[model samples]
Each structure stands twice: as structure tokens, then as C-alpha cells.
Target: MLTLAHALLPRIHHLAVPLLSGCSNDLSSRRAATGPSNFSIFNRRPTAENRSRLQALLSEERYLALDSYQTFGSNKKNKEQEATKHTKDIKLQDGSGTNSCQEQNSCLENQLETYEWQLKILHAVLTASGEQEREQLLKDHSGDICTLIHSISDKVKTEVRTDLNELHEKHLKSISEQYQSEAEELRRIHREETAALNEVFASSEKTLKEEIEGLTSELKLFKELKRRVEESTLKRDLQRNIETHGSPGEFWEQEQESLLFVIEMKRQHLQEQRSKLLQMQSMQNEDFKVRMENYQSLIQQLSREQNELQEALEQQALQKQKLSQEKEELLFKLLQQRTDSCSSFQLPPVLHTHLSPS
Candidate 1:
């Protein structure tokens, strides 16, 4: 039993060495590759200083190896605990199954021990018996011993094979169940995370769309207000121009026509005054001609009376002188009146200059 236990220890150690090394290697690679960026969607990662510190720690071969060893040990401990719990549960669930296998294993061991003891005893008896007796006994029991040994070995082999098949099937079933459960959990977590991300995206998109619409509305309102303000300003400016400079085409035309009418009336009045002055001048000239003819005829009659009456010659002379003086005075007054009328009839050059363009 000691020898068997020792032999199995070596085999167990050999199997564990590669597994431990592989686990250590995998842990070191994972640690080296993992970064802060792997955890977040925003891509925020560890600072360069933190990365440098981690690299510095990893740079020491002993520390790196120690860390990996510690990690692997912790993982192994956790796995061992889980395995122990699972084994306990299985024992609780199916205690009779393990008990039966143990009984069968003990039974097979007892049978093997019995078979070995029998062979040992037979060897001792043969040694103790004479050569002839031993030969005779061997010839009688050799075939039977061979057949019995063969039968026992065949039974043990069949039992062990069946147990191994059952164990393998149980292990396969357990592993498949574990994988299925883990896959389901992973799928559930993925679905929840995807839904959360989609919800966030939808909310953000809605908010942005609303903000854009609001901004667009505000812009349109500003444009409309600006247009209205421009229109109002233009209207105000037009009103001011009308107040200062009068209305455009129609008002200007009316004002121009009125001015022309006033100018024409002024011109007609000036012409009428000139014609009346000319008629008054002609009448004054005719009255002066008649007065001169009457004076000439009176002078001739006074001369005939003087010739006919010498005694009143002196009085006649005086009367003729008085008549000549009165005629001169009347002629001077007519000339002065003609000059005043001519001066009064003359129009200003400014009026003629203003009317010429029209």
C-alpha cells in the first residue's frame, strides 16, 4: 500500500507541474495585456503614471512571478472550495451511489488479496511436499488454478471498466451542465447591457433632436423679427420723406401745375396793365392835339379883333399871352402824365425771366 501510494504521488506531481506552469503563464499574459480601457465605454484609461508604475512593478521578474503565483494559488483555492462543495452536494444527493462503489471496490480488493494468499499457500505446500507428490498435485490442480485466476481477473476487469465508463459519463454530464448554465448567464447579462445602452442612446438622440428643433425655431423667429423690424424702419423712413419733401409723383405734378397757373395769371395781369397804359397815352395825345388846334384858332381870332378895335389892342395882347402860358402848362402836364404811365406799365425783368422757362 505504501509503495502504491508513493508511486501515485509521483504521477500526480508530474501531471500538476505542466498545469501549474500553464496557469502561471496565462495569468501573467492576461495581467500584462489588461488595461483600464477594457472596462469602460468612454475609453477613459489609466494615466501614464499609473501605467508606468504597473510596468515598473512588472519589470521585476521575481515580483511578476510571485504575483502570478499568488493569483494562481488563490484561483486554485477557490476552485478547490467549489469542488469540495460540489462533492458534498453530490454526496448529499446520491450517498447510496458512492457507498455502493466503495463496497464494490473493497470487495474486489478482498478478492484479489484472497487470490494472492491462495497462491502463496500453494507455493509453500509445494516446497514442503516431496518432488513426486508435488508433481502429481501440480498436474491435478494446475489447470483449475489457471482457470480460476483467469475468471477472477476477467470479473475484476469488467467491473472496473463499467465503473470507469459510468464515472466518465457523470463527469461529461456535469461539465455540459456547467457550460450550459454559464452560457445562459452570459447571454442574459449581454441582453441586459444591450438594452441599457440602447435606451441611453435613444434618450440622447431625442434630447438632441429636441434641442435642434428649438434652436431652429429660435433662428426662424429671429429672422422673422428682423424682417419685420426692417419693414417698419422702411415705412417710417418713407413717412418722414413724405412729411419733409411732400408726396412723390402725383403731389409734385399738382404743385407744378398750380405754380404755372399763378405765373400765367401774373403775366396776363401785366399784359393787361400795359395795354391800359397804352390806351390812356393815346387818349392824352388826342386831347393835347385838340387843345393846340383850339389855341391856334383863338390866337387868329384875337389878331382880327385887334385889327378891328385899336382902342382894346392892349387888353387883347394880354389875353393872348395868358392863353399861350395856359397852353404850355397843359402841354407840360400831359407829357409828365405820359412818362408816369409808361414807368408804371413797365414789368420787372425777374418776372419775364421766371416765365421764359415755363
Candidate 2:
């Protein structure tokens, strides 16, 4: 559009200058002539052929200007579409370009009107019977024509600047909207990811909780079975001792005390293990796998200790059985010696009763 304005500027200057010069010359010639009023060298009317030629030129110029305006309008439309599609890369268009186009369009129309008026005034001046009418017509239109031409360039520049500023603002607004949309999309995606992570954590937590419960139940069952086995073994040992001694002896009492101590120790160990399990259960912040591993290790340690305790108890029972056998042999020897020494003497009933083996 700017190029178009620049091109039209020179054309307007060339066309206006020659026509204005010829008008001035004709008016001067009319002023100088003293012949009857109208008949003079410069006052001659233009021929029909000249009038036809001028009309054809004016029509062609008007047609060219209209064609250019239409072409510019189409191009502006295409460029606007492209701008909308690729907002980030869009060039700043002059905001007042449309107004400039309209104004220039009006200016061109005014120029054509002035030209037509000038042509009419020229014809009338040549054909006028007197000088007064010619002078009045020139006086009425000359200033207006000059003023329009002089202001055209300034108006075009101002409107172009205005148009550019407007385009720039529009471009900035588009970019802002684009940024806002992207931000919203990012926020939405973040929310979705957060939700997904929460879901996964929840699922894992639930699974871990279930697994812990299952392990706890298994541990309780194992401890119960272990307790029953130990109790049965102790009962069997006690029964064997009872059958051998025919009564509970000091050895049996000592064995029972040792067994009670071991049971107390085992109970204390179980209580400690239970406390550890409770502590582990309370530590929800720790990782599930780590806590699980700790629980497994603790259970294994308890099992190892239980096996050692069982082995110790078996060794103690074996030693007690050997001592009981020696004690029985000594009692039999003492009984035989007493009976020999008192063969003609009567023994005390309490002593004899005590010396008799059960």
C-alpha cells in the first residue's frame, strides 16, 4: 500500500503540473487579448477529438486505481488469514492501513473530481464571452486543488503509522492468549499426573498392608505351633523322669527350675519381638520392602535362638539322666553294707524304711 501511494504521488504530480500550467497560460492569454471578448489564440475551445481522448484517459486512470484497490484488498485478506494461522510469525500490519486505503480512495476520487472540474473550467474559460467568469472559476477552485495535493503525502504517512501500531498491539494480544492457553494445558496435565501418582501410591500401600497382615498371621501361627511343640517335649521329659524315679526328686526339681527359667527367657524374647513388630507396624513412613525384610530377619533370629535353646535343654536332660543312674547305684550299695553290719541287730523301722529303694 505504501508502494502504491509512492507510485501514485509522482503520477499525480506530473498530471496536475502540466494541466495547471496550461490553465495559467490560457488565463494569461485571455487577459492579454483585447479582440471582441472571446476570440483569441489561447481562448480557443478544445476539439471534440481532444475531449474524447481526455475522457478515455481519465476513465483508464480511474479503472487502474480501482483495480489496484481491489487487488490490495484481496492481498490484505490473504495476509490476514495467514496471520491468524501462524500468529507467532505474523508481521505487524499497519492498523490504519484500511483507513489509509479508504482515505486515499476518497483522495483519488476527489482528485478525479477536481480534474473534471478543472477540465470544465478550462473549457468554460475558453468559451466564456467575458473575463470575469473565468477569473471567478479559477479563484474558487485553485486553492482547494493545491491543498489536497500537498496534504496527501502527510496523511498517508500518518495513517500508515497508525495502522502499524494497531497491528503490533493485535500481535501482542495473540501471543498473550497463546501463552495463557499453553499454561492452562500444562496445569491440566500436571493435575492428571498428580492424580495418577496418588492412585499408584494408594494401590501399593494397600497391597503392602495386606501383605503385612498375612505375614503377621503366619508369624502368630508359627509361634503357637512352636510353643505347643516345646510344651509337649517338656511334658514327655517330665514323664520319663517320673517313671524312672517313682517320685519327683531333687534332680527333677532342679530340672523344673532350669526349664522355668528358659521358658521365662523365651517369653521375654517373644515380648521383645512383639514390641519390635508393633514398632515396625507404627512406622508407616518407612518403605514397605525394608520393613518387611527387617521382620523376616527378626523371625529368623527368633527361630535360630529357639533351636539353640532346644539343643541346650536336650544336653541338660542327658546329664541329669546320668546323675540319676549313679545316685541309684550308690543307694543300692549303702543299703547292702548296712544290712551286713546289722545282721544280728534289729534296725530302726524309720531307717529301714528310708533305706529301702522305691
Candidate 3:
């Protein structure tokens, strides 16, 4: 950056030195460049009439940079107001709970971008002006012209780099702090949610285990009853066999089938609960992904807006340059016409003197 300043300073001095040392010659060169008529006007300006006209032209000449600066100032003010309003709106939204802090952060980021752009525009406008216009502006605005010039030189030497560094530092710090807070909040929420989920899962598992234990105890009781009944039946059957030679086994087979059906139902209930838990986890992950996508889209939108603004500034500069050139041409034509009219009036005088007999 210092190297850039050093490089520009020589060019600035070159431009300024010519204007300071030989303004008339510079004006003559400019007139000569415009057209033959302007060059004639410049030559004719030594006469009293032409001198007065030249003085009038000099007095009435409006520097293009003056208007450009006024326009820049008005636009800058309006933009600043708009940025302030935007910030206020963000604050209001935040206070009302209508938008999150992230939105406020984004708004601030946009404001910073706008400020940076405005600064660049200001720098361009200042540096783009002709040396004469700059000199006039400085003379009009400052009491100590030399001091002001030196100050400007010093500022040009370091200000651009300093300002850029400050802006970057500010932006980086804000972004870092914002992300840090967000990350901390996310970590806290994650911990809370994880703990809650763990508690819920533990409770569910405990309930399932209690239920399984109860079912196991019930199955054990049924088995014990079946064993006792089988023992009694065996004794009775044996007695019956002893009394009336017979056998019984169909009842025992029916009891075993009923116990198998109860076990299958318990297994099906456990599988259904596991599937529900898996579905809930999947839904949570999808929600997180959607949120991430939204954030990325918002960042892209901000970048696009910044790009558009930069392009607009560049177009405006181009248009301003074209307008300035057109204005200069018009001024030259007007001066040429005035000089022609003055010369025409002098023609009749010379004709009268020639026509008179001496």
C-alpha cells in the first residue's frame, strides 16, 4: 500500500505542478485541443473586448467536479439514512422477536459493505477530478491551502490502507464473535437435547424391561401351574389307566401352543417401539440439514447484492465521465460562437473606414 501511495504521489505532483505554474498555457492547450475556433478565441483574448469575454467565461465556468461532488454528497447522505433506517428496522424486528440475531448480523454486514462501497466512490470522485477543479475546491473550502494540501498528501500516503485494514478488522471481529456465540448456543442446545433424549430413552428402556420382567414372571407362573396340573393329571390318568386302561395328551399340546402365541405378541410390540425411535431420529437430522441450507442461501444472496451495487457504482462513474466531456464540448462551442459574433461586429467598422474618402 505504501508503495502504491508513493507511485501515485508522483503522478499527483506532476498533475498539480503544471496547473500551479502555467494555468494560462494549460488553458490554451486545452482550447487548442478543442477546435480551431477555440484556438482563435484564445488568440483573440488579448484584445479588451475578448479579455472581458474571457474573464466572464472564466468566472462563469462551472467545474464538473463541483456538481459531481454535490451529487455524491447527497447520495451519500441518502444512503447513510437508508442504512440507518435498515439498522433500526432490524433492531425493531429483533426486539419484537420477528427475526433472529442472525438477521441482525446479516443486516450489519450489509451496512458495512455499503459503507465500504461509498468510501470507494468518494475516493474515485476525488481522484478523478482535474487538477484545476481540485485546486478550486481546496481554495474554496480551506483557509490554509498549503497545509490542507500537505494533509491530503499525508492522508493519501496512508489512509486507504489504514481504512481497509480497519474495515476488515471490524468485519472479521464481528463475524467471529457472532459465529462464536452461535456455536456456543448450538453446543448448549445440543447438550440439553441429548440429555433429554437420553433420559427419555432410559425411561422407555426401563419401562420395557419392567414389562418384559412381568411377562417373564407370568410365563413362569403359567409353567408352574401347567407342571402342577400335569402332575395331578398324570396321577389321575395313571389311576384311571389302572381302573380303565386309557391315555391323554391332546390337552398338553393345546397349552404349549397358547404360550407360544403370547411370546410372539411381546416380540412384535418391542419391534414397533424400536422403529418409532428410529423415525424420530431421522426427522431431526432432516430438519438440521434444511436449516443449514437456508443459512447458505442467505449468505449467497448478500454476496449477490454487493456485486450488483459495485456494478452500479462503476456504471455511474462512466456516465459521469461522458457527461463531463459533453459539457466541455458545449462550453467550447458557446465560446466559439461569442468570438465569431464579436469579430462580425468589427467587420462593419473596417468597411466604413475603407469606404470613406480621406
Candidate 4:
């Protein structure tokens, strides 16, 4: 019922504004015809002597003729102000001092009928109480549907205030408790990890110094081999680019596999380097002899340049993973936003449920 009323309001305003404009023109015509009420409507009454005065008055009121939207808004505001004055008070046409039992029953019956209609409207809105979180929404706010008609009639200011305050307080307390629990868990983990990383970093640095000396020599050899590999890869990429120059889309589609292959090779190279680092990290935990020959056997034939290229590739892999994650997260956030908008559009069927009277 409320939705129907709301839908009607704008169309009504559209219709009413033009009607009023017509009436105003009629009134102005009447004013012009005052001296001769029976005069034809098309007849002009402005005299030559009063022409300047008439022009000035018309110019000042020109805004009324040109600005229909402004006029409609002003009229709507006046209506709201009038309705506000009627709040908490109903006017009876007859100003009788007293009413008999039959008259009183008839008045009560009329009020019941009106209330029933209001109840039906409320039911429609309540069906949307899945809480789309829209303010100034048309939904029935069915949270208070448990209240009886008698209770509704006798609702006091204190009752409303208390309900609102209680809901707010309860909501606040839950939010605070949730925050505190998360903070406490984070603090506990920080304390535990700080001590562990300190001890490990101290031991790891000593081992890393010993391994670096051994690995440097091995990396020098690998560096030469890696340079040749990158040069070969670049040449292949250039050849492919030249071969498929006509269509960019088709070229990219063909290149996808090659790009993925290159990325995979780079990933494998990083994994190999990471495995070497992991060994050093783990060697610190072992009880084996401090023989430097084990480091020699463990070290690959990679040269210094290969190690540097491998490090750069590892960084690129990390960045690529981060980018992929961010893209997924952005799409997920967009999907969530779309879901929220769709939620707001609770159809008439769902709203009809909560809107129904208890």
C-alpha cells in the first residue's frame, strides 16, 4: 500500500502542478475581468496608461511562469509542513462535547478499518526485513512485529528510546569484544615469533657467510651458462614476434604458452635457488661436522650472474603472484558489491512476507 502511495505521489505531483497552473491562469483571468465578470476570457484589460506598471509586475512574477520544478517543490514542502502540524492529533468534523456508546463504537470501527489497511502495508515492507541496510527505505521494519495492536496504540516515548538504546549498546559491545580478541591474538603471535626470528637470524647469518664464499665460485660458472640461456630465449621471442606480426590477438594467443613456459622455467630456477637457501637454513639445525666440503658438494655449477638472474626472477615471481592475488581480490570485491546492490532489490514477493500483519 505504501509503495503504491509512493509511486502515486510523483505522478500526482506531475498532474497536480499543471492543474494548479491552469487554475492560477484562470484566477488571473478572473482578476483581470473583475470589473466586467462577463467579459470574454481572451480580452486584455491592461490600459495604455498602466502598460508600464503591468509589464513590471509581470516581469517580477516571470519566475512563476518559467520555473515549474521550483514551484512543485515549494508546494510539496508546504504540504509536509501542514502534515507535521497534524501529528499526534486527529480532527473530528463535529465539535460535539460528548458521544453516545453507539457513536463511540462507530468511531472505533472506522479507526480499526484504517489500522488494518496500515497493517497490510506494513506487512509488505516487513517481507524485505532481510536487512538490506537501506535507510529511509520503504520496508516495514518488521523487527517490532511482535507488539500487539493495543501495545502499539499505547506505545510511549520511553519504550521507543529504551529499545533503540538497548539495541545500540548490545551492538557496540559485540563489536568491541570482537576487536579485542583479534588484537590479543595478534600480540601473542608477535611475542612468540619475535624471540624465534631473533635466535634464527643470528645463527643463519653466520652460516650464510660461510656458504656465500663457497657458492660465489660455483655461481661464477653458472652465470656464463645463464647468460647464454637468456640470450637464446630473447632471440626465440624476437623470432616469434616477427613471424606473427599481422594479428596482435592471434600473436598473443600463440605467445601465451611460450610466456607460461618461460615463467615456469624461471620458477624452476628460483625453486632450485630456494632449495639451496633452505639447505643452509636447515644446516644450522643439524649436528653434523663443520666440514666446508659438504657446502662444495651442495653448491651447483651456477655462476654469480646466474644467481643474480635467479634472484631477480624470484622477485618477479613474487610480484606476479601478488598481482594475481590483487586482481582476484578486486574481482571478488566487485562481485560482493554487485551482490550487495542485488540484495537491496528484494522483490515484492519477499517484501510481502514481512509486510504481512502478525
Candidate 5:
């Protein structure tokens, strides 16, 4: 069943949600006109709107009773599930039972639903025989039969049981005078049941009286509330009419003033927000500007050092050229002395120049 409900949940929600949403307007309209919805105890195929309406109508006790009902339902479902398992176990062990009997057996736990539906098969069997045989038949079907009758008319069962118990108690006290020895034991058992039923009857009567009083109080309150609502509605209509046709110039002036006040409030709010945004943006821009300035200053300093290094390289190159020229001159003088002593080879001319550092 859980698996089945799980699979069906999306579909159920899909179907139910639209219906529930559509109902909400009606519920809200009803509440606005009156108060809460009528139902406070019973919930039948409840929609979301119905649930909301019920919440307003329900007292704390009624709400708690709903919780108790859910818990009780859960317990009953667990018992039915156990009974189903028991039936399945019986089926697994033997294959002798007819299909109809098996179906009836499987439906045994559901006997709690309706007396007629549950006891159909039992009545069919019982009516096919005589009274002596009927007693034997009734004994065989006692479980299913009792459950069906009790499930169908729970109040009737209680009342009948009470009557039987009283009869038994009377019989027990007057056993020698009234009942035979064979009936004595039954009388004792019957007496015990009567006492219990009388107590239940008394309690039920008290509960009903309390419920009636509470309902009466609630009805009185509802009538008072209705009167007040009608008065409020009338006042609202009168105010609307007054606003419709009176003193156009003065009305427009007041409306203008209200509009201006609203605008001023909004303007102040927006202005504050704008100023905060500008301050944050300007702070970021200032930080960016500082970093840009630092970068430009670093570039200028690097350029100055680059020019100085170039000037130093020029001075070093000039010094090297002067040294090379002096060595060439000394060599030329030696060559000229060799030529004056009777040499035939001619020497090439060389120019020497010097550059200072910039």
C-alpha cells in the first residue's frame, strides 16, 4: 500500500492541487463575510482550502481529536496488514481451498467495513439449513459474523450487550428461584458486562450534554459577530460614498500633499543609496589612480638610469680607442726606422680620434 501510494502521489497531487487552489477564493470570501468554515470535527476528502477553513473553526480539543483519529487509523491499518499476512501464510501451505472461499478468507479482515457485505456468505450458508444445524453453522461463522454486526452498528451492539448483562445479573442473584443450574455460569458472566455498559452509558450522556452547551455558546458568539460585520460593512460603504461626491478641490489638495510626502520619503531613501554607491566607487577609483601614479614614477626613474648607463658605455668605448691608437703610433715609428736602413715595403696611413662621455 505504501508503494502504491508513493507511485500515485504525483498524480494525486497533480489532480488535487488545481482543485484546491480554485477552492481557496471561495474559502477566503466566505471567511471575510462570516468567520470560519462550518466543519470542526469531520474531514471528508479535504482540500487545502477546506483544511485552512477547518483550522479556523476547530477548537484545540477538536484538533487534538483529529490527531488521535489518525493514530488510531494507523494502528487499525497495521492490524489489517498483519491479518493479510496471516491469510497469505495459510494459502502458501495448502491448495485445497476453493477460489471463492479463498477470496472470502482474504476479505475476512475487511469485515469491519460493512455488515451486509461481510456477512453475505455466512447468511447464504446459514439459510441452507434447519435451526439445530443453524446453531452449528453460526458457531463456525461466529468470528466473521460478530465482526460484521459490530462493525455495522457499534451503538446497537453496546445497547444490546447492556441489556443482556442486566438480564444475567438478575438471573445470577435469583439463580435458584429463576434460572437452572446449567444457566448459572452464563448469568455470572452476563452480570459483569451489564455493570460496564451502564458506566459507558452514563459517560456518553455527560459528553453529549457538554457538547450541546458548547455549541450553544458558539452559536451565540457567531450571531454577535455577524451583527458587528454587518455594521462594519455599512460604515465602509458610507465612507466610499462620502469620498465619491464631496468637495473636489479640497480632496485634490489633500491627495496632492499625501503624494508629495510619499515622493519626498522615496527621494530621500534613493538619495542615501546613491551617495553610498558613489562613495564606494570613488574609493575604488582613488586606489586605481594611486597605483597608476606609482607606476608612471617608476618608469621615469628607470628611464633616467638607462640614459646614465648609455653615457657610461660611451666613455668606456672612447678610452679603449685611445689605447689602441697609441700602440699603432709606436709600431709606425719602428717601421720608419727600418725603412731608412734600406727596406722596400710601403706602410698604410692610420688616423687616431678620441670621444668624451656625454
Candidate 6:
């Protein structure tokens, strides 16, 4: 058992060393290569590959560890039973004969205690407790715990990393899908808008084309009606002139003669009007002379009346001045008469002075 335990120790060390170092190197390299990867979203293959490798190594290491522990556990159980029986046998022996038995019992108890200690360490490592508990276990069994911890910690790290990777991949996938769906919706909206705009533009263009056609037809009809009316009026006038005259030559000669006769009549009428105008002009000149004499006589009479009126106004102003002076003298006499009448009463000097006018 001792030799087997020693052989297993080296083997466990060999197996644990490579795994711990490899996992450490990988973790450090990954951390260094992808610094502050809080927003990383692209790389997944490398992590998956590393996870697969870790899972394989961890599975193999875990199977070996559990297998070794199972054999150890079974052996420990058998040894415990045997030690219990042997302790009972030592207890049954005589008191003086118990020295060698007690020594052997002590040796067996120590061996069992060491085995139990080792079992406790294994249990603590497998259970993967809190930091304090782990630290305590490590302090109690540093060498054995070191070998066990490397494999167990790597397994735990691999599981946590795998879970995180899976979660990250799911999140990235969900975000990508959502983005794609939104982009597709936006594209659909754009297409609908484009189609609607195209329809509106087509309808507007069609309406404009129809309006242009209608206007063009109306313009053509207006031009045709105007031309027809002008032609009809021209034809009627020509027909009436043809009926009045014998032929085109006769019409032209008659028109020329009629125009000459009308011109001669107008000239005669104008001459008579000119003679009447000359007579009226002479009569107006005689009336204007008579009116000028009347106007001059009226102007002389108005001027004489204006001078007489001005003299009357000046005489009135002088009479008004004399009346105002006489009124003032009468007012003074009336005041003096009042003062003389008031003197009989022996009025106060102040009253007399107040009654006197300035």
C-alpha cells in the first residue's frame, strides 16, 4: 500500500502538472491576446476549440481521479473495519501483554488517521467549497491538495468558460437575428414607399398629360370656330357686294365712282361749314368787342364803388372813435356825480377811493 501510494503520487503529479500549466498558459495567452474584450462579438471558433480541448482533458483527468478515489475509498473502508476488529482484539488482551499490541494499535490508528485526513482533503477538494474552506483544506494538506486542486480547478474553470461561451454565442445570435429582422423591415418599408411614390407620380403624370390633351383640343376648336366665323362674315359681305353690283369689274368701277362722289359731297359740305364758321367767328368777334366795353364800364363802376365804400368805412371808424370817447366822458361824469352824492353821507375815505375809477 505504501509503495502503491508513492507510485500513484508521482503519476498524479505528472498528470496534474501538464494540465495546470497548459490551462494557465492558455488562459494568460487568451487574456493577453484579447485585452478588455467587453464588446467582443466576432471570434467564437477559438474559444470553442479551447473548450473542447479542456473538456476532453478535464473528463479524462476527472475519470482518473474519481476512479483512483473510489479504489482508495474502498480500501479505506476495508482497512477501517480491519482496524476496528484489531483494536477490539487488543482490548481483549492482558494488561501487561498489551505493550506490543498497544504499539501496533497506535500505529494502526495513526495510519487510519492519515488515511482519514487524506479522504477529508479529497472530499473537500471534490466538494469545491468557499475560499476560506479551500484555504483551510490547502493548509491541512498542501502537497496532496496541490495535485488534486490543479485538475479540479481546471475542470471547474473549463465548465464556467463553456457556460459563458454558450451564453455569449446565444446573445450574439439573438442580437444578429434582431438586427437582420429590423433591416428587412426597413427595406420592406422603403420598397412600399417607393412603390407608392411611383404610383402617385404615374397618376400625376397621366393627369397632366390628359389636361394637356384637353387644352390642345380646346385650342384647336377655338381656332377653327374663329376662322369659320371670319370666313362666313367675309363671304356674306362679298355676296352682298356682288348682289349690289353687276360684276367684279362693275363692282370695282362703281365702288371707285361712289367713293369719288362721296368725297366731292364731303368737300362741298365742308366748304359750306367753313363759310358758316367764318360768319359765326365774325359775329363772335363783334360780341366780344361789345362785351369788352361792358366789362370796362363795369370795372370803372366797381372801382368807384370800392373807393366810396372805403371812405364810408373810414368815416364810420372816426365816428366810432368819437362815440367811444363821449361814452368814456359820460362814464367819468356819472362816477363824479355818484362821488358827490356819496359825500353827503360822510363815507370812509377808503370807500370813496374804491368807488373812484382809475
Leading candidate by lDDT: 2
Tens digit of per-residue lDDT, candidate 2, span 16-129:
344334444454445456432443222344446544554555566566666766786788788757666444333244333234445765776566556545545544544455
* Deviating ranges (above 4 Å) for candidate 3: 1-152, 155-160, 240-358
TM-score of each: 0.31, 0.37, 0.29, 0.18, 0.23, 0.33
Local distance difference test scores for all models: 0.48, 0.56, 0.48, 0.46, 0.46, 0.53
Clashes of 3: 0
Per-prediction CA RMSD (Å): 65.5, 50.8, 25.2, 34.6, 58.1, 51.6
Query: What lDDT does candidate 3 reach at residue 70?
Result: 57
Highest TM-score: give the candidate number: 2
Name the 10 consecutive residues with the lowest summed lDDT in model 2: 349-358
Model 3: lowest-lDDT 10 consecutive positions: 349-358
What C-alpha lDDT, on a 0 to 100 scale, does residue 219 get in candidate 1? Answer: 60
Model 6's TM-score against the true structure: 0.33
**Candidate 2 whole-model C-alpha lDDT, 0 to 1:** 0.56
Clashing pairs in 2: 94-163, 94-164, 95-163, 95-164, 96-163
TM-score of 5: 0.23
For model 5, how does the per-residue alpha-carbon lDDT over 91-182 read when each residue is reduced to its tens digit?
Answer: 78885444554364346424322332333433333233444564555456656544433332334335555765565556445543332343
Q: State in Å the error of residue 232, model 1.
A: 2.9
Report the error of model 5 at residue 358, Å: 39
Q: Measured by C-alpha RMSD in angstroms, how accurate is candidate 1?
A: 65.5
Question: Which parts of model 4 are misplaced by more than 4 Å?
Answer: 1-211, 216-228, 240-249, 285-358
Which should have the higher lDDT, number 5 or number 6?
Answer: 6
What C-alpha lDDT does candidate 5 achieve relative to the native structure? Answer: 0.46
lDDT of 1 by residue, 177-253 (tens): 65556556655765685576567656755765686577568767865886697569656866766887886665556
